[model samples]
Target: MKYWLGLDCGGTFIKAGLYDLQGNELGIARRNLAIIAPQPGWAERDMPALWQTAAAVIREVLELFGIKATAVQGVGISAQGKGLFLLDRQGQPLGNAMLSSDQRALALVQAWQKAGIPQALYEQTRQTLWTGHPVSLLRWVKQHQPERYRQIGSVLMAHDYLRYCLTGELACEETNISESNLYQMARGRYEPALAQLLGIGEIVAALPPIVGSAEVAGRVNSSAAAATGLLAGTPVVGGLFDVVSTALCAGLQDETRLNAVMGTWSVTSGISQTIETGFDHPFVYGRHAEAGQYIVHEASPTSAANLEWFCQQWGMHDYRQLNQWVAALPKAGSQLLFAPFLYGSNAGLGLCASFYGMQAFHQREHLVQAIFEGVVFCHMTHLKRMLQRFPHTRALRVTGGPAKSAPWMQMLADVSGLPLELPQVEETGCLGAAMAAMVGTGAFPDFTAAQQALAPRLESVQPDAQAQAAYQHKYQRYQALIGALQTLQSGHSKEAL
Candidate 1:
């Protein structure tokens, strides 16, 4: 009757899932996250509101299943990476947390690139400069909000902030911080020189001590216990980045297999035993859920979120009709194209989301199809880059909202010319976090063992030989358009609109 609890805080939803040791999902509950955007190109979440949302869902799941708080073994969390979540000098929330999709630091990133900052540090950080990175946002704060910068007490990402909320202990999980550009990749620890290099030397002390994935971060204190229905002193493990959680749940049994996550961000990742660098385009590396391993990836804020934006605008919530529209269209003959960069871009800085080559004959369905393909195309851009680094890559383990669609999954497989692996994981973020909890609570020796015992059923979507040829041609057009668009992006800013 032992159980593990996982809380997934995502940009779109705050989900809580309860699972047994055998990986059976006992219950799940979710609440849509309300993103606060006071200015254009800004995405934020109120800290207190976020914690309340998480508490509400956690309580709902426990009550809905009638599970005793004492019966739950441990708790783990999985959340979006690289957003600025802070606590001021009094250990109170500073302001609304900046999301990974926020573009307020676009000008700073561009300025740094012109100064060859990213290029100079790429050998050490192994990450390209991005507007949404914590360093970028922190620099923006130090220059623009000097008072708040001086008042800084601690700097943390979304998951770290949540872990602190649960346990009242200040810790930085290694996996998420590895991608923050504040940590030295090769040395596998925080280096103050990196902070100085990024122009935020004063905030070095704010970086908390690092903790391993399966280690006990802290226990749920009385405050969190009363807020949520959990018992006091329930152990909480150092959680994971959502992508890391998804990879473990997707059954990435070996290095040959890759994982693609399509959500608020389109992330393509592969695991490596040793760190590899020296790429023309730097691939971001984060500490793996497993000790001594690394997860190398390329990601952008271009994915199914595009559909969410359309849903908000058109006032439609369901996906069946959109899939049907895309399903009706033939794959190869469409002349329309879409750049899925509403939130962020993979091509380069300051790229706007747009539909190109639209004709009078195009209908709403055609536009929907273009959106699907545009998202897939953006994912492919990252996938193609990853394949160069992971040349031995064999299969893709896919997950996320878009993967639920047969038409969309088929498009991804056909475009990549590789077989798509769909694991029977309903909530990857939750299940992945549970895996960490299981390990921390001594349910398994490590993540690999935990996954093997709870391995999910598998479904495969193979590429079509005929469709692959057509997709190769279509992908060429997508690449050409991206090239043209990048050329026209000189001095442009997404926030300018």
Candidate 2:
């Protein structure tokens, strides 16, 4: 049977999935990729190693399923957004791949804020200045690693780099690069003035041509065929930003339901036909895989990773037990709150992850409950903003590691007062990448057709009225506490008033 291959390059893992035209999962495989941190606030990966990991996972999935490379008709990819991957003048890995979690550009972001660059460009770019954004990272490199900066030949994101390795092509998929702050959203092209305004005009030459997500990028080349065990002439499509992949896999075809992803970054995304900005906070917009659509989202590095942090520290993995404990607790009575900003902050920078209102009576289980609630609270912050734009949203399609926990999903539902659907797919990224392939290869006419052909199996969660009422009061306190902290953080309150 003819199948498609999808490579999903996440922050810490690279996964491959094999799918039939009917959207049935034929087989899947994954490999953990190393996250190299030579210094605090610096996250890098070996680019060549990343490519090998992609190849290895693809080969393993094909071999494990007893499928031939020639049987795979099309290939697509989705990966973490905004990481810096570069090829030198020699068409080799520049130095090390910088990850989206990397904060080497934190100070540069602060400087930009002081200089009003974000405000100047917000109407055009629609992305907030962040440490991990390619715009910030490029400036940081020019100042700190000038040697490496000078050798830049091509700049791309993780999936874009992997696509290059497989197809020997240089291009930026629209969904990823649209958020890079290099591209002008309304103009539909990269404006050199943006690079010049950001003081990185010299590196604009490194940016590649833009490619649409479901368009054929190139054919897998002979060397890649030998390395990945794929047919040399297999068509490969331009890929997606990981968040877009998840949104598509969750079947977010319109603004009726928001897609909430609770991974390393907590994200709430909605699909719209036109650009909508001018929010109390910055809302990012990305080109959607579907033609004439845009994905508007608010995200941060605050999400399920906080639970992972607690798991690592306390040597606990009994999520079933931990979740039971959380369910048993009284949600309204707990005064405890966690910031969930261990990696990055949505509230603002210079704020660290912390717990408030802890008492002597609070136990480890209580702390676990606080961690879960804190992450949900952070997501609510983003969700509330999204709801302002998509006011008719009736439900939330939630995805990620935390969605598996009943307590967590229910908490999100109660807090948002919207029904939530948890997708059963093991890897939405891989599936969405495959959907792109399906559309590119004419298996489906467009993204909407692909969605109808492969709707995800979903489980639902309804909000508890009592819990919603309680959370309403608790949420006020939550906002008050965040405002108090912000007053202490910047001597100015974050109250919406």
Candidate 3:
């Protein structure tokens, strides 16, 4: 039987899966990588360390399955988005990889906005101008490190860079290239005008050629085979940003279906037959695997990441214990509401996390519950906007780290007023990549066929009416808290007079 490989490169770890044509799992391996947070609002990863760990997991998965590299049909890769990886003329990494969450580019973004580029930027990129974008960072680099910037010959996203190492080819997939702020979403290519407007026209020269996802860019090289224990000529197919891969894994190809990937951050995505732009629905839109299709997605920058911060502040050990503690709390525990915007939000400006009705009597569980509730509240806001855009959504599909917990899933269903379907395998990103590779190399006819043949089991979670009703009341309080926070932030700015 033929086999395929799928790998997911995340901020916290890299996961690999080996599967046969039947979609039955043959083997799986994972390697955790270190996240370097040298200063506030900055997240970095050591490129060498990440590549070494990824290579180790690839070898281990192949060895565990006793598969020859030449025997494998193809490989698919899904990776975290918005990371900046610069390479010199010889393809050597220039500096630490800047994560999607890094905010050092804020000054540059401000300057661009002041120059009256925000609306035009949105028109071109379909993404809000923000500090986390590669375009902003590239401009920042030109201003701060002209010497380092001049040595660059290629710049790729996290997975694109790794693909280069494996295939000895330099190219960026459409979904990823869209994040660079240089991409014209409607045109489906990089915009030279935007680059020139941003005063970083030369930076585009370092970018890789854009390619369609599922295209076989090249075959693995001899050195890669030795390090990864695979056949030298194994084909590598195009994959996408980790979020889109996760959406694909959860069966989000249909225009009426939506997906919520609740991990460190949370994202709500759905397929749009055509790009639609309007009030309060600014989103990052990309093309689907098929020609002439688009994927409309909006993200909440602080979801589970907010929960992690609460746990750390309260000295909790892990999410399970913290979740359990929160689950046991009384209804409307502490009456303390959180806005879920600790990391600033992608939704709108002046939104910040706030604590309403806090008291000295409140305990750690109350705080934890509030954190989770805040995230659910944010998702509900997005869900409302999504339904407005796509009024035909029948059900909601969820997949990610937090989706594994029963209480969290229940809370999501209860809070969002939508039934949730959870896949048996939470590692859908890797599986989706594997499926893409399978089809890209003809192991399967297409995605629909692959889903029926190889997709894992799924279980549905329905909302409990009682809990839903109770959360409904708290949901009102949550909305009020958001408005009050916005008012407070606005008042603070005006008070400077």
Worst lDDT run of 10 residues, candidate 1, spans: 488-497
lDDT of 3 by residue, 63-135 (tens): 8878877677888888888768889998899988888777777656756776878777887788877776788
Task: Compose the digit string of candidate 2's lDDT tens values, residues 295-379.
Answer: 9998989999898889989899999999999999987568887888888888877667888999999998889988888888889
Per-model TM against the reference: 0.97, 0.96, 0.92
Give the per-residue lDDT digits (tens) of candidate 1, residues 387-453: 9988988889999988899999999988888899998889999999988999999999999899899
Question: lDDT values of the candidates?
Answer: 0.89, 0.89, 0.79
Worst 10 residues of 2 by lDDT: 488-497
Q: Please list all clashing residue pairs in model 3, or write none if there are none.
A: 69-231
Runs of candidate 2 exceeding 4 Å displacement: 491-497
